[model samples]
Target: MKIYALLFLVLCLSQQLHAKEIDVYAFCDASTKFLKKLSVLPLEDLVAVKSAIAASSSLEELSVASGVPYIDWIEDTQKQLLVSESDAKLIVFEQVKPIEFSRYSRVINMHGVKDHRLWDKVLNDCVSVNLAALID
Candidate 1:
């Protein structure tokens, strides 16, 4: 029994160590060239992406860096690359978030909007169509 417990602990530790790390992508439109370009972003670019995560960074920075105003979030869900909005909108893995978003980003970009009412609505209603969780 002790041996079994030890084995279980070891397995858990190994799994934790080997867990897949999430990757970040910003999209402005659905374009193969854009997807391919993002897939091969340099280490510096990767750092930029990492910094641009929600609350930690802004998509504007990514836009300035990449010359694209749109962004998308992509992750591996159930062995398939799932692309989705933070609001749980499902998009093709290669699809880019629209620059002229009427919902979240627009409000976010608006002057004196002050409250994240629009963003909160989308976030509260977020539901994954392909994945178990929306934000992971």
Candidate 2:
């Protein structure tokens, strides 16, 4: 009986862990250069990239403004874009989604690439804004 109870607890804990979803933002240029570079990255490299992006002052501001935590970066691809279901919110470049990322509660579409300085304003206008609106 104790073993069965332990198993149940483990299962419940695992489910809760998986429930925590990370928001993934896919950024790309007109040629999808950034996206292409991102897609080929290994899992470790991806995590490193996430850490680096999260560490950026600009992205930190964006996270605060958008009220999103754990934002991961990925490259958008035609094949990956076909799948409609995802556990993460997607902030994609304009016209990148062919099927539409309906799974995510928030799908932010950014217009033409902007300099870091303008990113805060863009995110504030398109999404949400907070004390971190000003990016230095």
lDDT, model 2, position 9? 27
The segments of candidate 1 whose C-alpha lies over 4 angstroms from its true place after superposition are 1-30, 56-66, 70-136
* Model 1: worst 10 consecutive residues (lDDT sum): 22-31
TM values, all candidates: 0.22, 0.20
Count of residue pairs whose backbone atoms collide, per candidate: 6, 0
| Candidate 2: pairs in clash | none
Say which candidate scores most in lDDT: 1
* Number of residue pairs clashing in candidate 1, backbone atoms closer than 3 angstroms, sequence gap of 3 or more or interchain: 6
Worst 10 residues of 2 by lDDT: 98-107
lDDT of 1 by residue, 24-134 (tens): 111111221233334444545444443443222344443454354342222222123232344222331112222212222322333233345743332333222111221
Q: Give candidate 1's error at residue 100 in angstroms.
A: 13
For TM-score, the strongest prediction is 1
- lDDT (10s digit) by residue, model 2, range 6-57: 3222222323323223111211121134323334445554444444434434
